[model samples]
Target: MDIAEVLTLADDLIFAKTGKHLDYVQDAILRGTLEDATYTQIAQELYSSPSHVRNVGSDLWKTLSKGLKKNITKNNFRAVLENSKIYNYQSAIVGENVTVGENVTVNHNFNVCPEKARSPKTPQNPEPTAKQPRIDLGDAPEISTFFDRKSELTTLENWILSRTRLITILGLSGIGKTALTLELIPQIQHEFDCIIWRSLRDAPPLASLQTDIIKFLSQQQETNPPNSPLSRGGEEIQPASPRRGEEIQPLSPPLSKGGLGGVIHHLRSQRCLIILDDVQTIFSSQQLAGNYKPGYENYGAFFKQIAESCHNSCIILISWEKPREIAALESHQKNCQTLQLNGLGESAREIFTEKGLSESEKWSELIDLYQGNPLWLNTVAAAIQDLFSGKVSEFLSYDSLVLGDLEYLLNKHFQRLSDSEKQVMSWLANQNKPVEISKKPALLELSPSEFLKAVESLRRRLLIEKVQKGDRTLFAVQRAIAEYLNS
Candidate 1:
């Protein structure tokens, strides 16, 4: 039975006993219980004390027991109601097996107790009190070599604790945005009721992504496992043991039906931490940063709702490009926030030390050249090891940037640029030094306004660097990027 059916049962039973309908707290408790939430989680959601919630639950359960003239308790309430839904049958429980209709079919190795019996887990049985939220870190890479980002971690924690509803960790590929988030999860998972990490690398449509997430967050488990023994039109039904990992508590019903509306309901009711990685894939290439691709524009509305709505949940977006709404909607006291991740500094020496690179004194020069990007440094460090036996000084003697696998990484970013952006990048690559905007080459047929817009776009994309010469603003591409373009 779903939440509504259970609630109707509760109301009918309670009203018959006391001639009073369920109150607000009573209704909230039923919703929380149906979702497999602990009393503490429900209490926190309603800003009420756990003791108070338990007190109300106890009184309510006693009333139910009187109305039914049968044993009814918190753990068994759902089971009793569900069992009542089954068609007329001759049933008996023998140890871990429940037999129906003359023992023609037996559900073996299962928990079939109306009185909280324990064996192989089934929906009717009560599971242990849950302290951890349900987690699904799909395709979220493990942090094998995380460089310290203590400050960033602290900032993210503070924002989440303070109820920031939306956060975007923005940076170029190879930066430690994904790494930092992976590390942060262990430190904060206990604070939420559900935590999920999804990768947008494949750019799954919003509806598909939303549906997948809803299914995970849902209290209702998926359809029968391949081993389920029951089929429709057949009288006998056998509930099988959990096919996956440890058993999940059975939900009375899902708060969400499935879609944007369903998603928002779950977010508002449960404390969820949703991490969306590789968000750039949902955005259009060859355009300014954060413009969603044609079919993906609805993500803007979804993100805006996350930021504008009053909810206790949090959504974290990890991307190479900042979404347009991020700059426009974020405020000092608002729930929306953005973190543009930069490179690791001295902490990055660990990558060199791990790579067995020599000339510790020259490591900083190499790090500075690669802008302390972890993946870029790792790629170059390997080339240095193969070509120069891990000698930093020997590699430096060549005075040429080492971009082995980095070329592929850079090419991925290059492929996403607009024509204006490409022309600006080409111009910057050939420049001898940082030059003022007024000194554009005549051959680069762009007007002043177009040049400035392209430069600004590239800056937001982290493809070009800005410098100050006297009082004039100067811009130039990084050596590795320039070399990639020039090559």
Candidate 2:
């Protein structure tokens, strides 16, 4: 009867009765009730009026009561549900007038009764349930609040289920890349034999990281080692490619060295899900995006090997920048893909509601203004609560954008741009509307090549907007970013 299970069961029952699933407000009310939250607290959390919450809760209880064939009230909801569950479990019938227990018998006779049907032989050894995978979430942050990402989670799950070996999730900071991936784990973790989440923020060398991961994966092999040469102090014998005229590349794995080859051997040994976070840390700052820092160049090779080597495991890289090889790999290999996370759409209204912001109608305007980034919306929502007394209309009345604390975040993104890219951003920031960039503008200081490169780089960083007007492509900077630069 935990909140998740209760909500799921309630939702299913309600759907069965009404032919419709529970709405957001109803879901919120049920969750709030489970936590013993007051109507006032629930109203404030949803930015709803107390009257509306009460009316909805009243109707919801009545619906549940009718559906469950029992009296259901807000105060006694938990007890009613528990009793209903127990009743249903005991009422289930395996056979007519038959009791199920030790040496149970059926009173009714069948027309054809085999020997086993008369006296079923019991199994001497019962099959055990499958064990959960070993998981090590190193330094992974806990998600305090989660917004809806059902579509994103489904897409990621489909990719993993299809046996794609390498996935890189790219997004602007605060766009919920980590949150989305963390949410994805539960949906897809059952497909993996082991799951490991590690952060690359400290820029661990490729060899060291490889060794660390290999050490962890080797344990799965130790517990369930195959009767092959691998565990007999010898090299593994790889299976031959199917005779379908498809060429297969052979691998020469060196288990002794802490290198890509060794990592591939362990990856091939089991179905593991390895997540490397903060991948942008390994790239150099003040340079074009995704250029590796000095002495970190080997990571490019490691990534290439993970994508190219034949293995059953998946490696997910989370970062703010897309690595250079990703595009080429995606075009060349079916198992390699990149997902660039972006701002939310209508779903973002939930953030304002959670922050107790007023004027629900104006939320879309505010979400659009902040580009629908979850963290950015949360940040701006707090600002709206503090400066405008939670009035969205008043915040929008100012016309000009405000970046009270968002400036620091913008600074981080701008600092990563090269000189040419910064110039392009400055130009874009000064423009009042989205501009056509199909042709090089005379106003920009850079040459044609430099301008195009900068524009491409800015697009990759997700710092600029891309729009279409008739037959032309237009680009524009977000109002907040422009305000930051102007300030």
Each prediction's TM-score against the native?
A: 0.67, 0.68
Q: Assess candidate 1 and give its lDDT.
A: 0.74
Clashing pairs for model 1 are none
* Residue 347 lDDT, candidate 1, scale 0-100: 93
Clash count, one per candidate: 0, 0
Per-residue error at 149 for model 2, in Å?
1.1
lDDT tens digits, residue span 5-102, model 2: 56655765565455445554576688889889888887665445576667778878988887666778888988886654432221111223333345
Per-residue C-alpha lDDT of model 1 across residues 1-487, encoded as one tens digit per residue: 4665566556655554554555545666787877778888877765555776777777777887776556877777777766654223222323334332221433332222333343333223223222345678977987788888999999999898777889999889999999999999988875576788999999999899888888776642345332211121222223222333434222213634777877776676557899999999998888876778989999988888878776678999999887877777787455889898988899999999999998999999988999989999999999999999988888888766767788999999999898988998998899889877875567778887777778878877888888987888889888889989987
Minimal lDDT window, size 10, model 1: 227-236
Candidate 2: list runs displaced more than 4 Å.
1-128, 221-257
